[model samples]
Target: MGKTLDNVYKHQSLVYKYFLYVVSVALIVFFFPKGGKFKYEFQKGKPWQYENLYAPIDFSIHKTQQEVEEEQSTIRTNKTDYYTYSSTVVSEVRAEVSNGINTLFQTEIFTSSQRESLRNLSEEVLTDVYDHGIFQNMPQSRGTVVVKNNEAQPIAPNDYQNVELAKKAVTEYLSDANSYGTDRLSGIIRNNLKANLFYDNVLTESALNDELSKISYTRGEVDQGKLIISKGEIVENEDFKVLSSLRDEYESELWMGSNYYFILLGYTILVALVLIMLFLFLKRYRSDIFLNNNKVTFIFFNILLMVVATTLMVKHYENFVYMVPLCILPLVLKNFFDARLGLFVHVLTVLILGFVVPNSFEYIFLQIIAGIVTILTASELYKRANLFISVGQITLIYIVGYFAFHAIHEGNLDNIEWVLFGVFVLNGLLTLFAQPLIYMFEKIFGLVSDVSLLELSDTNSKLLKELSDKAPGTFHHSLQVANLAEAAANEIGANAMLVRVGALYHDIGKMENPTYFTENQITNVNPHDDLPPKESAKIIIDHVIKGIEIARKNNVPDRVIDFIRTHHGTTLVYYFFKKQQELDKDADPANFKYPGPVPFSKETAILMMSDAVEAASKSLKNPTYGIIDAFVEKIVKGQMQADQFLNANITLKEIEMVKKVLKQKLTNIYHLRVEYPE
Candidate 1:
């Protein structure tokens, strides 16, 4: 029942933490970007056709006719200058309308009622103007005017426009608009201009030109020479929607622009999410304290590395983007996180960053392949130590990765020899240099990685050395725990290294009283021998607590202290309580017990069981392997039934595995000596 309540309390304690974790991780997932490489997409057409064609080839030299003639002539133009060959352009405009309804009329440009009025006026204007079309002109003799130098200029039938003809043409068009209101005179002028521009009569063209020149000073008419409409220039309407003209609207542009933005944004999210997920998974499997902190730190470090690498790759030299995501990510992640996460994140990073890298899926696939192979090659890299081998290892991953990439992406491998040579140089030279530069990013981020583990075993480390001097008894207990926990962790497929490291300091609290604990005793005069067993048990129980206080002063981690306090639960002090029951029959059951909160964690519970089993197994004079096996199971089952192993989340299956492992370990630890004496 007590064990049940401890379990309940332990669960209650995790509720808030679980809530925080879920909410934070949910935020991450909500914002988690999905990763991808780009498919073959039509980016866009070149800015302009002439510019596009010119950019690809050099066709700038301007050749002359003489140069063209000097070359082998395919066709003859002129051998002799019999009549100086030249070109002449003549546009004969006439006011003639056979025709059709106005197609250029935009209803929005002109209102509905106004559109009807403009149509009626246009018809009336066309008819009246066509009726009184050509200007009445008297034909003059066509003769050649000869000068002193024999310059002969021809004199035509109609020399130029006269005042009478101009008045006649203007008067006739004004008569067309007499019936209608002053609706669209400019529009009328435009219609007349279009007719004249397209008409084939020279006499009618002369009249239209004469009428326009007569009103040249007036703002009502506009004449910019030969044609009213320029041949190639673009014209647009009011709403900027290019109704009947040729200009690309901004709407289509914005649509394509947004798609590009979404793709880049999505890719960024993907890189970040993959790294975060990898970090989270590793943290859960490792020891909770380090797992949580180490992963969080590494995640931030990864984001920083990616952002910086992206910025530099894009800013300084654009070609290296393909290299950074695949090569840099794996190298840096290995330097900052463990090799496992580095491998997975490297794959994801390569795939995602491919989108922003301006490469197709086929091109980026090689990057992913190379990075994964590189990380696999460097899996055993110990960066803080083994600098020489580590560099070689990184170089190998880089080289192997690069070649694999080159091979995978190289659709045409006609250059296999060259590719192989490049791979060798890349692995042997480039990676050696690149890996070190990438390592700097990991250091800058303050992320301690697996290589940083060596510092933990340092004798000068505050917690380890403090355990040795101040709390030698707890320290001894911790060593026993390290062995037991690591063996159990290994059996369960947990992080044995993490378990051992944590276990080494689990009893950091007991150092408060070096002489109080049994393990630290030099002489075998049990301290309880002088006192009532009840008082003795209280003193023994107090050591678990005293260990906590000492551990606290020394700044031992909470995970370590948890083992110290929870190792011995609130189980009754059986020896003391049973003794009091006989001597002082009325002594309260609770009063004789040591205050124990049952084991509430796997490490602590394992320690408690192992600590008892290890001591108990030493009692037999001839402790054999079979005896150790039976004793191991007995101690484990005893602890379980006593309810001391309840709240730790340690499964019975795991406990059974622990029993089996303990038997094997204790056999070697307490191996029986052969009876050699005769």
Candidate 2:
């Protein structure tokens, strides 16, 4: 069993790739709904393209989403209140009367007879206030139903009054008893009164929710075999509602039917077919990503992740599905790969989501257009402003697409759902965070994005800075090679940024023994001259190994490190080997060659040629334009004869273009331009 798994783990094999393709497709297909799909499509205010439609079963005509939401908001605003009557209000009134009488007797503000009359007036008025019920504000329209001893009594809207009004009644009762003490008596009575008719939140919420749930979701019913709409007839708002209800009823009935499992199987197969197309596309065109398990998994993971997010939002927060930031997928993929692959994956994801979301056509249409805009405007994403601009364009596309669809449906822009437009704007803002997401994926999946490459190419970066201070000459050589390679890569339609960054850090190993290499040696004493040929060749070859170590230690991406490993392309250090050969006829040449796997990509091949041509161009004495052109040809031609570029995915035509760029660049550097007369 272990051996069997070992064979499966070999990612480069055809069997391994096929296994991953099946597994990835299977996992994505599992997220699809088990309910059956409708055979025909319909939209509001559009002509019915299919034949006359009829309902096969009796189903309720559900209200539109907008109508249901509006009803819910109204219910929440005017919900009935459930009140628990506390006999505590009577006790509170008695306490207020007792405290008032005690204070009056202690202060002696009133004579004995007047205090006695005040106490009698206060008791009668307090009893009347408790009976009328001192409440907080006025009662709601549906009325507050007070519960006591399992009996519920409804209080009228006008029956409940504020505590101040209750105190005024007490003051009126006392005005005749003591003409001077009416206002003072009211103040003492009002301070002790507390509204005991407290709002019962638990019971109130339960009652409100019960009322909301009782609100019928469906207003009418359609009988079986009823003709819904005729062919070529425009679907009005009423007809659209009936059709949507029928769709929901059909799906719900199918879920409980005996053929439900078969429907699930069909959905699984459909999703799998879409995923299979993507797999074949990668296998045929993007085999570099296909051959690596991590990269292929990353792509499928992103697609599945986006689908899951869309599915959850559609199932729950249906109105806010547009705010899920679907465009972020294409923007991130485009930054890592190309626009074509990004758009392709995004289209597939949106299609899969279309199977589950409402108004499938509009959702798919808006997302695909936004994805295209994302790919077009998100180039050079290392610049923060480019992402911002791209997000703006994507949001604009979403808004325009939504408005156009709305105009078709309603025949006017009156009562547009402007909140959805705000959702698209929020989506655009969320997409700007894809840079950090890209960095996270790079860490988790061991992938490198263009943003990382751009940062690595900066001369002020830590590793580049160290290289400059330790080995200035090698750093200068690297910069020239970067310039030459970048131009050549652009000419050949290769990844210019990747090759430029790779060229900048290709010889970082030379920092370990800076003065041994002639480029970094500034002193008269030559270190290599004192050592034997084999020993000196070992020192030269060790830079490649040491450079790999340094790069890995500093967390350099492996893609850039490939240039360091393959720049020499199994070529011999001829200067030292020839010196040994002159001393002894049988000196082994293998000891002087750099260990290499050869270049496997156009960018790496361009680097190899540029590195060779730029280093050799320094040897030209009193160089002319023709001489520099020939010098570029000789070094590249020798490398071609050695078949150094055979393994790289580079064509002879592209190699010719690289040579043209190199000759022109070297001429500018060495051969002077004709001075124009003033």
Candidate 3:
């Protein structure tokens, strides 16, 4: 087991790990909602282009979403809602009223005989009111009174009220007595009587739910093998109902039986095919990325992340799928790599989602167009305004594609879902965050981007500022190298921003011992004259190492640090080395060479040549175009013979282009042409 674990860590196991990765991704995608796709695509108001359709199995016609919702609303409107009547409340209130009447009669305002008569009159009237069945006031003047043991009795709403009804009853009862005493008796009843009946919320809700459960959701059914619809039949309301039901029953039949495994297997194979195609493309063309596990993982991670996001949206938030920022994946990938890879991954992701999202054709079509727009427009992420413009274009494409598909499906735009357009706008706004996401990717993956390169190229940054303040001559030389390298990079379709930034910070180590280098020596009294030739050579070689350390300390990107390490390309300090050989013919040559893994990229290679040519141009006494041309050729040829650029992925033709660009730029700097008479 330990040996197996060790083998897994070895570089030779990369292929196995990649296989495991692909399998894991395929399995995850398989677990998502890969609903069984209908054999033919159909839309409302469009003709059925397939052969005559017949029911394959016995199934009931199902309702559309709108129909189901409307049926539910109608049932809720007509459903009998129950309310519980508390018998104990009526009895308790009757006793309280009797006691209140007795207490009122105890006052001196009533004599013994009068008190006795008043009690009799109140009791008789209250009894008549209680027999009427007090109930809660309800809308439409009606309510179902739920009694004990779940017996529901309907009653009028006016039954439950204050003592005014009781008082009226008492007034008629007292007609036989004197009218003068009846007025005084009604005042006493009004002051003491209060409402007793209330609605029981818990029982009402339970009973209402019970009634709702009894309502049948499936209204009607169709026999097995019934003819549902024929080919080329316009899907009117009734036809849509039959088709919607057929789809539901078909999906249900597949899910409940063993047939779904086949569907799942098909989904897995399809997703795996797309992923494998992507891997093959990368391995064949972008082999550098293919070999690096981290880069390959980064690309796959983004694709998987977007897939998971889309699947979740489709499953739970089908309506808000438009609100997802699907364009972000292509935007970020294009900024990091190229437009082709970005669009490729985006297409694969949307295709996987097509199986799950409702209206798969519309979803896939809109996202594909948006992804294309993102790739075409979102290139320079360093410019903040570029992302805004790109996002706007992506949003516009989404809107146009969505409406066009809607128009095709509906045969008109009058019923278009305008809310989805708002969602698309929100998606575009979210896409604007891709710039910050690129920064995060750069940090987490240790990858550099154009945005970071642009920030580094600024002259006021800490590292560049220090180089300028402490070693002004090296700083000026770096500026010239930047211009020369940028021009050359543009000529060869290289990363101009990266090459320019690299040229700017290439000689930062000279600030540590600025005077030791010839460019920074402002005095005739040279510091190197006081030291041995080997020691001087050591100082020159040490700058590359010191520059790396300083750059790391200051948080420079690894790509920028490449220029610092490879600008000299392991070449010997010829002046100091020759001087050392004169003193001791056996002096070690290794001590004079810069510690370098030579320029491994075109940009770094360009920086090396540009740095050499620009610094050499400074030493010419009688400068002319011919002198500049010869100087450029001599420096570039010498470096080529030393094989400095062999590992840098630069071709001979590209090197010649760089040479030509350097000569032109240096001649312009020196004003080598004949001066016009003033």
TM-score of 3: 0.86
What 10-residue stretch in candidate 1 is worst by lDDT?
81-90
lDDT on C-alpha atoms for all candidate structures: 0.51, 0.85, 0.78
lDDT of 3 by residue, 1-678 (tens): 989877777755476547756765675565487457666666777776777777887777665556666766776665444555456766776676667766665654777777777777666656665554443454332444645446666655655444456556556766666633456565555455444445676776676677657655565787767776778887765776677777877776776557778877777788778788888888887776787777787888887777778778777888898888988898888777778888988998888778778778878888898888788888788888888898899888988888787777666777677888899899999888788898899999988888888889899988888899999999999998999999999999999999999999889999899998888888798988899998888888889999999999999988789899999998878999999999999988888888788888899999999999888777898887778888999999998888898788789999999999998887788777775769
Which tens-of-lDDT digit does each residue in 444-479 have in candidate 1? 543333344344445468877887887676676667
Greater lDDT among 2 and 3 belongs to 2
Candidate 2 clash pair list: none
Stronger candidate by TM-score (1 vs 3): 3
Output the number of the lDDT-best candidate: 2
- What value does the lDDT take at residue 93 in candidate 1? 17
List the candidate 2 regions with Cα displacement exceeding 4 Å: 1-16, 73-137, 140-210, 512-515, 523-538, 576-592, 675-678
Write candidate 2's Cα lDDT for 1-678 as tens digits: 988887767634678567766776676666665567776799889999999999999999999777899999999888778766667776876787678778867876677777766677667767777664666655665657777656777777767767777767666766756555656667778778766666778998998889889888889889999999999999998988898889888888887867788777777788888888888889898888777778777888898788888777876788898889998899878878888999999998888888888789999888888888788888888888888888888888988898899999999998898888788888888888798999999999877888889889999999999999999999999999999999999988889999999999999999999999888988889998899988998999999999999999999989899999999989999999998998888998888899997898999999999999988887888887768778888898988897898888899999999999998898788756754669
- Prediction RMSDs, each to the true structure: 24.7, 4.8, 4.1
Q: Whole-model lDDT for model 3 versus the true structure?
A: 0.78
Worst 10 residues of 2 by lDDT: 176-185
Model 1, residue 220: what's the lDDT? Answer: 24
